[model samples]
Target chain A: MQPPVLELVDLKKNIKNKEIIRGINLTLGPAEILGFLGPNGAGKTTTIRMIVGLIRPTAGSVKICGYSIADDFIRAMSNVGCIIESPEMYKFLSGMENLRQLSNMDKRITRQRVDEVVELVGLQKRIEDKVSTYSLGMRQRLGIAQALLCRPKLLILDEPVNGLDPAGITEFRNLIRRLAHEEEMAIFVSSHLLSEAQLMCDQVAIIRQGSIVKTATVKDILNTETVEWRLDNPVKAARLLKEKWGIEALRENGNTITAAVGENRLELINQVFVNEGIELRYSIPRQNTLEDMFLDLTEGDEIA
Target chain B: MLRLIENEVFKIIFKKRLLIVFGILLVLITAFAYGQDNSLNRTKARLAGRIGITASTDWKKLCEQQIIDLKNRLESPYGHEEDKPATRVRIEQLQYYLENNINPLDSSAAKFTTQFMEQSIFLFLPLLIIILAGDIVSGEAANGTIKLILTRNIPRWKVLLSKLAALLMLEIIVLLMAAVISAAVSGVFFGYGGWTAPVATGFRVIGDRLETLGVVNVPQWQYALMVYGLAYFVSIVVGTVSFMISVLVKSTSASIGVMMSALIGGNFLSHFMSDWKITRYLFMVNLRLTDYLAGSFQPVAGINMAFSVTVLSVWAVAALAISFVYFMRQDILV
Candidate 1:
């Protein structure tokens, strides 16, 4: 009976007569992680900007903790923490000082909480050094520390791991999962790294050209079965599968055919190919990855 | 809001902007004090060469001689009609100094403090204020830290208001630095002994005539306070205008450039177009607010202290309104 931690209803935006975001609606509950995936110029950043109050929406509402962003901005924003783009801090100040500056803005934050977040992000080693001297990975950690200062109920991260190493990325994924599951916080993350998202996200929403084209659970997306056929004369094999067995197979390459048939059908499919005039090399069942689903949904647009 | 202002003040302090302003004041004040001492010694030497040993003790003779020369120039009929009133005022000032037994050439730290502010109000003081206030808002935008602040739980107007308050506080500090540095530096050269000296003020020019009814003599310290007060007013006006420009422009260097050009261009416009009636209404033309207290000559015809203050107040208010409205409604695309 509790309201969702973050909600967007009929969100829209227009810039100089060009529609940038067209009626985006989403809801995130407690302990949920939604990966917002989109190609370049697809309104991903624009949508994040609107949620953080950086850009005004043409028509719609962003509500946080049951408070409308437009009418109760301070209250709504108090419940949310975000990094819209790159995590930029005051370079002249030490990392600890930057955290102190942000902590001062909210009344609920305390000195103990600051140190806790610093330890949480593993920035305690170099926290007292000037941010200008900190590496990109360190700055990213400090930014996450700043966002966690007020114990926000909803966290929004845009390309949070763009500059991180593989180990850092894995560590960040674990931290995000822990935050969501243990703290019961709703997190919305926009990322171009689909493999990372596949490991970190519970659900994925792929957007294209200012509209949500697909939204599904990661488990559902990865659970969809398919059989790939590696054989001679893929064109003839595809036609034969469609005509004889009423199956639609996609010609992925010159000599390979993929169909949404279960793994049990692979043996029969191989037999069909052998009985026919086609020379069968092999047949294997494969699970769709988030990358594969993302490419299929976006039609290979440039992912930024 | 207090925390916000504290944040702003610390940011400016860490940026070393106030230190730069203080450094500039120290260097310029020292140079001007040295120049003044040299000029005063040169005048003393010239007077000693013309007269005998009595030149140092007898200032009345020099005053009378200068008055006589001015009177002769007034009667020669070779002077421009428009310049006659200023000459007559200078002659009257000399005669009044003689009557009051006050030597016009007796320089002191108090006198230097007042004089320095009067000379710097129109250009130097305003430039220092611009350096302090020009990037309060735009610097954050340029460096990408504006998003960090704007994404916090504070309202947009509160953020801007805190910045303005911090700027005003720093402007006061700048004026204080100018006064203290000028007085301190000049005292070492001028002997620091004129705080109780009498100074004449409240002179008015009404239609090509010197109006002396309002003239009164106050102590040199009181006179310095009035001059610095006027300078502070001018500083606030300049600071507010530049703060507004900071909001309108996102790049710090561009904001500073725009304000600098407008200020310098206004100075030139006031000189080249003094005859234009609209020129008197410009805030830049009225920046020399201390001139009214010192009873200096006016280049343009109809502006008085009340008129200048009104013009400046209008400009400051308009700029503040524009800044708040625009900032509140802006998308902050950067």
Candidate 2:
């Protein structure tokens, strides 16, 4: 229904004959959060960099808000907000002053917009403090505040919650969710923490060895592989599931049965195992988690 | 571009370091003027005392008597004017006055008083330039602000142009401060209205047969302006070169060290290159813009105003080109 806010088509990046990002294709749509998941050297940062125009792609092209990154750099960049690596800022300046100066780069971002974004990032109380005195979490919040100044259509943050403490991480997660939910911004965030991605993102693209191994909705990815289910009786459920419901399944050990589950299989199996005469200690359907899925996808290739 | 240049110019002119440099120059210029003024006053007083005695105040007759007294006392060669050029010239010129009534020292008192202002413009202003121009860009790079500036998505050319504008503004400010301090201090000591003052230098080499231009009498104000302008230009060229080296080198110390070495080395090499036949192209030779004030030939024999202008212009352009090319393409890993 809505045009993609940010799109990368078969992008490749090479440096000194070493390929960093090998053909990554991704699309971010309105009010969608795409979790870009990968290991440390799996081209996660490089792909995000190309999207934000920090570096040029060796091949393919990137488009932000329907504008080509190469042909219309200013316009494309105008629609995208990005935080690359750690928050690099002028430490000598106050957070508010830093935001004010960066906001001046684009003519459209006014003083009111800077104030609004500062408040949105929950840095209103400490905006006047110099960045040199900010803790890692506070700096991260300021970085996000700077990115949101123009209310960009697309926001790219690489490991946005990397250095946040537990409470800070909770606050950042809620703030990102609110920005996407209320502001209707397409959010593309990359992180190595699969649990963080699962809790934050609606859609995701998993990268391994500079290639996108899997991309889908969170439910679809969690459904891709079967999870090993542990039970009190084990082999009885696999035999019963296969024989009774014509389901494909596998038995791991005396107390565990592994089966690929569909969307409503959890409810169906709980009913089915209760209806049967087996002593149902636990009848939960086994579905692959994001962590397991990430490992399965990236396990075959060299990380760097 | 103008806005960027304005911001940069404001930063340079308002920087505390530049203010400190101006303050140092002001102190040195004031001290030199005060010191020179005291010596001039003492000389004037001694000459006045020689001329003020009664019975026509015959200073030469009295000096001769004093010399005879000294000769009788110490067996020294006294009152002989034939050996040393300066003393011989002074004694011979005073001989007529010794026969008449004019005191020899009072004859040149007006000339000495007039030339002191010109000497300030020539000598102290160049030192002021050296202090500011030596560290223009190196200071920014040393503070790690260059990368922060470059990442603003402002074009690389704009960044360099801004820096050049800043350096140019500081150079002008320093030059103006020197000029004002010189004018004010000289006015305080020598009492202003002698602006048509004459200046003299010891060695004026007259060239052969090209319309023999005699002693050039530049008004004291014009001489000050010319010396300040030329000194400012020389300082700006050095500042631009130092900026280029700052962009090229990794460390600020190295940038300052290299440019200062090149500056000192250029002057040192120019001394030997007088016989080298190609010393005219060296930027250091044109540094003595005051030589033109004395109605003499330019520094490197045949390199006139047009040649000095061309060489200095070329150096400035080349330095700017190298700075832009290197800075735009540098990988800002910092």
Top candidate by TM-score:
1
Candidate 2 i-RMS: 4.1
- Lowest-scoring 10 consecutive residues by lDDT in candidate 1 chain B? B47-56
The sequence of per-residue lDDT tens digits that candidate 2 reaches over residues A101-176 is 5665557888998988888878899999988899998889988887787788888888899789988888888888
Name the candidate that leads on lDDT.
1
Where does model 2 exceed 4 Å of error?
A1-3, A52-54, A125-129, A206-209, A222-225, A229-289, A296-304, B6-15, B23-156, B181-215, B246-258, B271-302, B325-333
> Scoring model 2 with DockQ, what do you get?
0.16
Q: Would you give me the overall lDDT of model 1?
A: 0.89
Among these predicted structures, which one has the highest DockQ? 1
- Report the TM-score of candidate 2, chain A only: 0.85
lDDT (Cα, tens digit) per residue for candidate 2, span B245-317: 8778766567767766666676766665665776667666566655545434433456565667788788888
Native-to-model Cα distance after best TM-score fit, residue B130 in candidate 1, in Å:
0.8
Q: What residue pairs are clashing in model 2?
A: none
